[model samples]
Each structure stands twice: as C-alpha cells, then as structure tokens.
Target: MTAAQYLNCLQGVMQREWLRFFQQRSRFLSALVRPLLWLLVFAAGFRAALGVSIIPPYSTYITYETYILPGLCCMILLFNGMQGSLSMVYDREMGSMRVLLMSPLPRPFLLLCKLLATALVSLIQVYAFLAIAWCFDIRPPLWGLLAAAPALLLAALLLSSLGLLLSNGIRQLENFAGVMNFVIFPLFFLSSALYPLWKMRESSEWLYWLCALNPFTHAVELVRFALYQQFNLTALLVCLGLWLLFSLAAVLTFNPQRAAVRG
Candidate 1:
C-alpha cells in the first residue's frame, strides 16, 4: 500500500474500534467501575492497613490509593488490551481476520495498527478514570497529566502486545477467560501496583525479585513517575524493550490458520 493508503487503513481500523467500544456502553462503565470500586471501597481499608514510605514520584508519604492509581491505569490498559485480542479471536472465528490479515500492508504493521487502536481506546478509559479520581481528591499536577500521556500510551502498547501474543496462541474464546485470569491477576498482585517494592522485600526476598522482574511492574512504575512529572529510566527501558519483544513475537505468530486448524 502507498503511504496515504497505510494512513487511511490505520484511521479506518481505529475509528472502527472506537465505535465498537463506545457502542458497548457497559464495557466502558465496567472499565471505570473496576478501578473506582478499588479506590472508593478498598482504598480506605488498605490505606489504614498499609503505610507508604517516600518513594520515587513522591517526596513524602502517600496514601495507598495514590500509589495504586498508576497500577489501576495499567489495569485499564491490561483489560482493554486483552479485550482487543479477544476480539481478534472473534474476528478470526467469524472470518473477518482472514480479510484483515490478507491486506497488502505488512501483517506486522496491520497488527501494530490494531495495537495502537487498542492503546488509543485504553488511553481514553485511563483518562476517564483519572478524571473521576480527581473528584475523590487524588489530583496529580496538571502538567503531570500531560506528561503521563506518553508513558500511559507506552504502557498500553506493552500490555496490549502481551495480550496479542497470548491471543495468537489461543484457539478458542472460551479458553481466554482462564488465560486472562492466569496472566492479569498475577501481573497485578505480584507487582508494585498495590504496594511498594520495598514493602514486598520486607516480606520476602524472592517475591520482591519476582515483582521487580514483572514487566507490568515496570509499566506501572513508568506511569507512576510520569504522573508526578518525573522520569524513570529503568521503568521506561523495561517497558519499551518488552513492548518491542512482545509486538515482534505477536506479529510473527499471528497466524489465524493455526487457530482455525486447532479449533
């Protein structure tokens, strides 16, 4: 395809994904409600139980809610990414993916476009969550909001790429729920999402290292620091590196024929 055609394809896919997302209003509300429930109901109990120390992106103690905000933002990306990939499974089964994957453009570029579409949608849900968090007094600086955009987008790509890679291997939609539970919950709970890494270290050394190794942890840290108008080199590097790795793998292995055969 020509450059203009490529751009048009990208735009078309993104617009289509966005329309589908907005049409399913419940999907949007559930995306917001999941994080809000944690912030509104669980934060209070966790805040009293767990004390946060001064950490990067924070000059002093912060509430548990503040610490988990970035994690929750990542959560939005994680779920959306998985949902996007789940749609891939649906499209493949319904025969649409065969058409999409057969385009003249490189399959990798097309998949990248799909990932970006998912990222754009995830970013919207994330911003909406942040806006709602603002009403509850979890305000970060206004500038920080702008700073977070790039980081959030990067994290979205990273998490979405992971889902894409996983989706390529999944032959059926029904099995995806079990796979999502396996991947998502472990990534969320084992990382620095709800608590600091240092706190994890105090409890268990191996657990701390595992959390540190989690790409989701790096993604969370990347978002957390950006939301405070700060930079985290390690987190940025880890997230970007893993995104490249996952995207490349997803693109190489995005074989709908394999899924169709296995199904």
Candidate 2:
C-alpha cells in the first residue's frame, strides 16, 4: 500500500476507537471508578495495617494511597486492554473484523494499528485517573507526570498486546470469563502492583518469585520508577521486549478467517 493508504487506515482505526470511547462516556467514568475505589476505600485500611517499608522511588515512608497510585494507574490500562480485546470479539461477531482485515493494507500492519489504537485510548483514561488522584493529595513530582507518558504508553501497549494474543490465539470458544479468571486477575494480583516484592517474599518465597517474573510487574515498575523521575533499566528492557514479542505473535497468529467462522 502507498504511504497515504497506510496513514488513512491508521487514522480510520484510531478515529473509530476514539469515537466509540466518547459515545460510551460511562466506560470512562467506570474505568476511573475502579482505581479510585481502591485508592480511597481499600488503600485506607491497608495503609494502617501494612507498614510499607521505604522502597526505591520513595525517599521516606509514603502513604498507602501514594504507594498504590501507580498500580491503580496500571489497573486502568489493564482493564482497558481487556475491554479493547472484548471489542474485537464483538467486531468479529458483527463482521467488522473481517471487513477490517479485507483492507489492502498488510494484515500485520492492520493488527498493529488496532493494538496502537487500543493503547492510545487506554493512555488517555489512565491520565484522567492520575489527575483525579492528584486532587486527593496523592501527588507525585510534576516532572514525573511528563516522564510517565512514555511509560504509560508502553505499559498500555504491552497489556493490550497480551490480551490480543489471548483472543487471537484461542478461537471463539466461549465467553471472556476464562480470560478474566486466568489472565487478568492472576497478572494483576500476582504482580508488584499492590504490594512490594519484599513483602511478598516475607509471606512466601514462591509467590515473590512469581511476581518478580511477571511482565506486568515490570510494567508497573516501569511506571512507578518513571513517576518518581528515576530510570529502571530492567523494567524498561523487559516491558519493551515482551511488547514486541506479544505483538509479533498476535500479528502472526491473527486468524480473522477462524474468528469470522466462529463468530
């Protein structure tokens, strides 16, 4: 395809997603509510119960709301990624997936565009959550907000790619319940999103190892350190590498034909 053709496709895909985002205004509010609920209600109780040791990116002991903000930020992205993939299943049923793939553009590029569009939408919601958190006094450095943009985008992409892989790999068998049970919660709860690895180790060595190995943990770490204006080379490399791998796998194994048949 010509350069203009590629640009047109990308623009169309992104515009369509954004338009839907606006139409379902409740989704945006719903996304914010999850994190805010945890931050305001759950974190408050945990703040007193769990004494958070001083960790990197923290100079002194921090409040639970402050410590959990990054994870909550990620929670937005995490759920958005799932929602985006869930849309893919809808599109497949409606034959939109077939129409999109029938474009003259390369299939891989088209899938990449979809992934990009999803991540872009999620990034906007994440920032909206962060802005609301700031008003509640869970503030990070002002410069950290700027630094977090790229980190958030990367995390969004990584998360969206993983979801895409699951839907694309597992043919239309049943509902998203399998994914929610097996993928989403496990990744979220097992990661360092809520608790530090040291604490997990204090509880169970194996659980700590699992959290350490989870890429979502790295994604959270990437955002956490970025929000403090610090760089974590390990997290940067892990998230980047996995995003590439997962994106590639999703693109390669993309089966619109099978999805269409099943849908």
Candidate 3:
C-alpha cells in the first residue's frame, strides 16, 4: 500500500478500536475502578503498615500509597492491554477481526494499528488514575507528568504486544485463566512494583536478581524516574528493547497462516 493509504487504514482501525471501548461502558468502568480501588483502599492500608527506605526518585520517606502510585498506574495499563488483546481474540472468533484483517493495508501494519489503539486507550486510563492520585496528595514532580507520556506509552506497547502474543496462541477464553494467574501476579509481585530491590535483597538475593532481570522492573523504574523528572538510561533501554521484542513477537504470531492454525 502507498504511505497515505497505510496511514488512512491505521487511522480507520484506531477509530474503530476506540469506539469499541466506549460502546462497552461496563468494561471501561470496571477497568478504571479496579486500579482506583487499589490506589485508594489497599494502598492506603499498606501505607500505614509498611516502611519504605528512601530509594532513587524518592528523596525521603514516602507513604506506601504514594510510593506505589506509578506501579499501580503501570498495572492498569498492563492489565487493560491484556484485556483489549483478549477482546481481539473474541472478535476474531466472532468474525470481527476477520473484517479488520481484510483491509487493504499490509496485514502486519493493520495488526499493529490495533495494538496502538489498545495502547492509547490503556494510556488514557493510567493518566486518569494519576490525576486521582494527585487529588489524594500523592504528588510526583509536575514535570514528571509530561515526562511520563513516553514511558507510559512504551509500557502499554510492551504489555499490548504480550497480550497479542497470548491471544494469537490461545484460541479459547477458557485457557486464559491459568496463564493470567501464572504470569500476571508473578510479574507484578516479583518486580519492584510493591517494594524496592534493596528490600527484596533482605528476603533473598536471588529474588532481587530476578527482579533486576524482569523487564517490568525497568518499566516501573522508568516511570519512577520520570515521576521525579529524572531519566535513567538503563531503564529507558530496557523498556525500549522489550517493547521492540514483544511487538515483533506479536506480529509474527498474528501472521495469517500461523494465526489460523492456532485458532
């Protein structure tokens, strides 16, 4: 397809995907509510109970609720990306994705547009959560707000690609529960989302190493740094690299013939 044609197809698919989220009001509200509940209720309780040492991006003692805001925001984007990709699989079975795939644009480009659309929706939800956190006085640097955009987008991209990879592999919703249980919680808890690597060190050096290796750790750190209006080259590289890798995997898994067999 010509460049203009490709751009048109991308825009069209994005609009369709965005409209899908709006039409499913319950789904959108539920997505927003889950993260808000975590930030407000669970994190509030934890803030009183837990003691966190000062870490990079945090200059002094901080409430647990304040500390986990970025992580919870990341969680919202992460889970929403998975949910959106799962919906794509359901749409494929229902023949909607087939209609999307039949567009004149290149197949990979079309599929990527879907991923971008999901990422956009997920990113917005995260920012909404951030706004609420600010209201609660869990403030990050004002400049962090603007710096967060790219990091948030990259996190959404990585998660969305992982979701696409899963949907491309698992043909039925029935099979998703186990993977979600096994993958999602472990990735979240094992990372620096809830605690610092130094804290994890007191528990197990191996656990600390594992968190260091986790791409999600870098994602959290990227946002944490951005929240302080600072940048970390290592964290940036990790997020960018993982995003590229997962996006390639998603594209490979969605290839027409390959997708058919998996379905």
Candidate 4:
C-alpha cells in the first residue's frame, strides 16, 4: 500500500477501537474513576497521615494528594495498556486477532496502530483525571499540562509495548490478572511515584537504587518535571530509551515464525 493508504487504514482501525471503547460505558468510566478515586478519596484520607520531606521540584509542605497526581496518571496509562492487550488476547480467542494479524499490511505496523489507538484512549482518561484534579486544587503549572502530552505519549508507548510483550507471551487470558497485580503494584509502589528517591534512600539505599533503576520511575519523574514546567534530561532519555527498546522487542516477539517454521 502507498503511505497514505497505509496511514488511512491505521486511522480507520484506531477509530473503530475508539468507538468500541466508548460503547462500553463501564470500561470508559472505570478508566476515569480509578484515578479520581485515588486522587480524591484515597489521597485526601492519607494526606496528613504521611509526612514527606521537601524534595527537588517541591518546596514547602505539599499534600500527598498533590504529590501523587502524576503517579495516578501513570497508573491510568499502565492499567489501560495492559487492559488493551487483554482485549487483544480475547479477540485472538474469538478469532478476531487472527484476522488482525493476517491483515494485508505489515504486522508490526498493525500492532503499532493498535498501540497508538490504546495510547489515545489512555491519554483521554489521563486528561479527564487531570481535570478532576484541578477541581480539587491539585494541579501543576499550565506548562506542565502542555508538557505532559509528550511524557504521557512516551509512557503509553512504554506500557503498551509491555502489554504487547505480555500478550504475545501469554497465550491464555485467565492468567493475565495475576500478572497484572504482581507487575503493576510492584512497579508503581517501588518507583518514586508517591515518594521521592531521596525519601526512599532514607528508608533504604537498596530501595533508592531500585527506584532509580526502574524505567517507570523515570517515566513518572518525566511527567512530574513536565508538570512543574521543568525539563528532566535524564528522565527524558531513560523513558525514550525504554520506549524504543520495548517496542522493538514487542515487534520481534510478535513475528509469526520467530519460534517455528511456517508450513
């Protein structure tokens, strides 16, 4: 296909995915609600219970709610990425994914189209969550809101590539829930999401390094810095590197004959 034709097909698939996402009201609302609940109810109740030190990018005492908004946004991308991949797995079982895989187009491009579609959906949910955060007086600078766009796009690619890795690895859907719980929870908590690396260092040097080493931590930091209208070079580089690496890995593993010869 010509470049325009290929792009048009990509757009068509993405539009279909978006339409289907909206049609499922529960899925749509759940995406918005989870982050809101964490920001409003969960963070509010725990704001005073947790004492935090002044970390870079933060001055005097800040509420926990304000601190974790970016983290919660990361959570939305993380969950939505995996959820989208799970949907793909279900489609495969129902014979739809096979048709998708067999499309008269490059397999990697098709997979990327799906990933981009999922990223768009994830970004919508994140922006909605950010709007709700504004109502509660939990917001970053205006520039942060603008900078968050690319940060989120990178995060989506990182998480979506992870989802692609998982979907291609795990042939069964029933096993996904356990993987989600194990992977998502640890990745979120162990990172500098709710706390700073320095804070984690005070608790445990090991924990501090672990957080520093985690790519998600970089993803969160990139968003956090962008939220404050500051550019974090290291965070940006780390996130970009991981996005490229994971996406390449996902494409490699998704090849039909990678493991066996075709008949």
* Each model's lDDT: 0.91, 0.90, 0.82, 0.84
**lDDT for model 4, on a 0 to 1 scale?**
0.84
Pairs clashing within candidate 1: none
Candidate 1 global CA lDDT score = 0.91
Candidate 1 regions off by >4 Å? 258-263
Ten residues in a row with the worst lDDT in model 4? Answer: 254-263
lDDT of 2 by residue, 1-263 (tens): 68988999999999999999999999999999999999999998899898888999899999989888999989899999988888887788667788887788888898889999999999999889989988999999999999999999999999999888887755553677787689889999999989999999999999999999999899999999999999999999999999999999988877767645632
Clashing pairs in 3: none
- CA lDDT of 203 in candidate 4? 95
- Candidate 2 backbone collisions, by pair: none
Using lDDT as the measure, the top candidate is 1
TM-scores for every candidate against the unseen true structure: 0.97, 0.96, 0.93, 0.93
Q: Which residue pairs in candidate 4 have backbone atoms (N, alpha carbon, C) closer than 3 angstroms, thus clashing? A: none
Model 2: weakest 10-residue lDDT segment is 254-263
Q: Give Cα distance to truth, residue 60, candidate 1, Å.
A: 1.8
Question: TM-score of the candidate numbered 2?
Answer: 0.96
2 against 4, candidate with superior lDDT: 2
Ranking by TM-score: 1, 2, 3, 4
Order candidates by lDDT, high to low. Answer: 1, 2, 4, 3
Candidate with more favorable, higher lDDT: 3 or 4: 4
> What total of clashing residue pairs does each candidate reach?
0, 0, 0, 0
